[model samples]
Target: MTPDLAPQGALDRAWQRVADREAARLRDLFAAHPAPILPARAALARILAALILLGSAALTLLGLWLLLRALGLGGVSGGARVTSGLGAAPLLLFTWVARPRVPRVEGTPLPEAQAPQLHALVRRVGEAVGVTRPVHMVLSPDANAFMGLHGPRRTPVLGLGLALWYGLRPQERVALIAHELAHLKNGDPTRGGVVQAALNVLHQTVSVLWPDPVMEARAGLPEKLGNLILKGAALLPLGLIHLLLGLVGADQQAAEYRADLLAAQVAGSEAKAGLLDRLHMAHLLDSALHKQRHQPQRPDAFAEFRHMLDTLPPAQWAQVREEHARLRVRLDGSHPPTADRLRVVQAWPSEPLLTLSPEDAARLDAELQPFVAALEAAATEEYLYRTSG
Candidate 1:
């Protein structure tokens, strides 16, 4: 694409190589300095992200004002007004699509009264990680966990994936909590309003331009042609996304390693690395969960998840790692490659700073019992619907 007529697969193949190389480079950076400062490029990316957000907002407003002036005050002819409206329609649609949004965590909300034990563990992990406890608790069905600032008030919320929780050891569970809590301390600039808004704007633009295969099947010839043109138009936004990734990729990775460092500091580094390793095997859990649709009886999804992990062969584990090695991380992904993360945490090994004992973990499990079956049912239903009929 650099010469403007490059081979079709060249860019994708090259990027995969770049990803592999970049991960090793970042691994070396972590090995050399366990604690990292934000690079100058990341600072520049922040400014550009802010500009992109502001510029889009400004252009939308300006276009709207000019259109309204021509229509109402300029006393334009009916034909002229219609023409102007048609010309402004696409811009207006993009403005509406790309409006700033408050993204909410989609999960069952866990009140403090209902989940006192879980709340207590959250508080303890918060203290261990040197951050205030997140006020809201969420029970997600997926095999991932996150803690983030949400809403206008930026109230901290912790969402734990029940499936992932089922598979983790007690100390590894502590590591999961610590990792999320550490995002509050780590300098992940994506947490800021400007960057988040900018990302959302770009994401919405891409969504509008990307030709959905489901819809494409029903499209007429003219519509299909339009989709092709729109797909071509997508190149600019995609390039901007790549630019954003290039500038902030290493810097964002540094934040992740920093958070991993905190996790290692709180929960044993070995446990932290173990958690990352388990996370990489998430697809195996996903496959098993989806298979519940064909089960002879209603299966206990949590038990199935744990059993899958327990029974996985050594060769299967290596294959899983190899499969993940071939994958690439895009800008929108939550974390760097798991192998790179594992390397970072493994390099700085430590014993448990905050352990979750078997007894306490059992108590916490009891607190989650009511939500467990519901989450598993919901997750199984979702996986079945998504993967098949």
Candidate 2:
């Protein structure tokens, strides 16, 4: 990838121009496909309302039981208590079942001296931006680079991609690096990383507890007539799963937007515009189409559990092992719909884009302010949202 041989001040000015261009681009994007901010806000409000309602209901229930005992109208009912206890069992089971396991990705550091070209570029960029050089560079097939704070000091790791390395021009590569560094400057990664980790664990737990049969059995009880009213509490964990996922999706999108703005500012408007178009085009041609091509070989978690069970019996184990072998094929699934991504990029006002009238530009800018504000709000909430159980 080509590094900007220009002086640091020149790079900064170029970056600022790109940032302004990106702000305009985002404005156009918001105008073209207005995000349903009101609906999302209403949904968020509803969640808070539901939480309050749940607390009130719980308090009311407790009050009713206490009043009954004081009036001598009720006392211990063994059968009812037993049924309630049975219903509460699943809720207790879920506490443990829905917890996430941290994935053990071994930290692999690459030798820096081997890639003098990259080191020189990063060093220059870091010096210009007033940030530390990346602690390590990793080569992975995935189209991603993240900066995060880990351990006591919150060090940075600049993970690179083999695909990006081969595909992007040197200038574009510099743009990518700038984008990641922006994330560090904005403190998005360091602030939001812990929440992401927590949600991962929560998702894993919910996946275990919300199997079809268990969910079906959970729905059989009526709330008004029985002590086993909470039989359907499994739905709580399921709802949490969706909430966690939505938060992650929204945060990721905002993070990308911020990074785009920052990178464009760092690398210059021309480079940013070129890189955006190329990145979208590359994704459309390569990764976007191939996203869902590989699936895990096992049919489901059931198959994994059954295989484990069968291992206890030599006779059954062989059949189970064979089934596992046959199922080892991966299912390819597409990531988020490409149509949405295409729409977003097309809406961006890059260099070659059609010129807008002064009035049209003003209109688009006015429309974008709220979305930009919403993005900021989402960014603010991300840290708290991620860490909450």
- Which candidate has the highest lDDT of all? 1
lDDT of 1 by residue, 1-389 (tens): 02113235977668656755665677688877887444587777779888888888886986686577557658878777777677677777778886777866667999989989888887888898898745687888888898766787777888899989988889899999888888887757676656667777788888888999999999999999999999999887788777776777776777788889899999999899889889877876666675564572334777678788888899989988886665556433446777778877888888888888999988988888889878988887788788785
Instruction: Please give the clash total of every predicted structure, in order.
Output: 0, 17
Q: RMSD in angstroms, all models?
A: 4.2, 20.9
lDDT of 2 by residue, 1-389 (tens): 11223335976667545533433343345436434131143245345435534543454465555445444455647666555555545544544454434333322344555555455566666654456746555444433455654454545667664334334444556667776776666554214444444445445554654445554556545523232423254466556544544434333444455455556545654555445544433332132212212333443222222233323456554553343222211011112222223234334443311122345434423432323333323322442354455
Model 2 misplaced stretches (Cα beyond 4 Å): 1-108, 148-155, 189-194, 212-235, 244-252, 283-389
lDDT of each: 0.78, 0.44
What's each prediction's TM-score?
A: 0.86, 0.44
Model 1 lowest lDDT segment of ten: 1-10
Q: Which TM-score value belongs to model 2?
A: 0.44
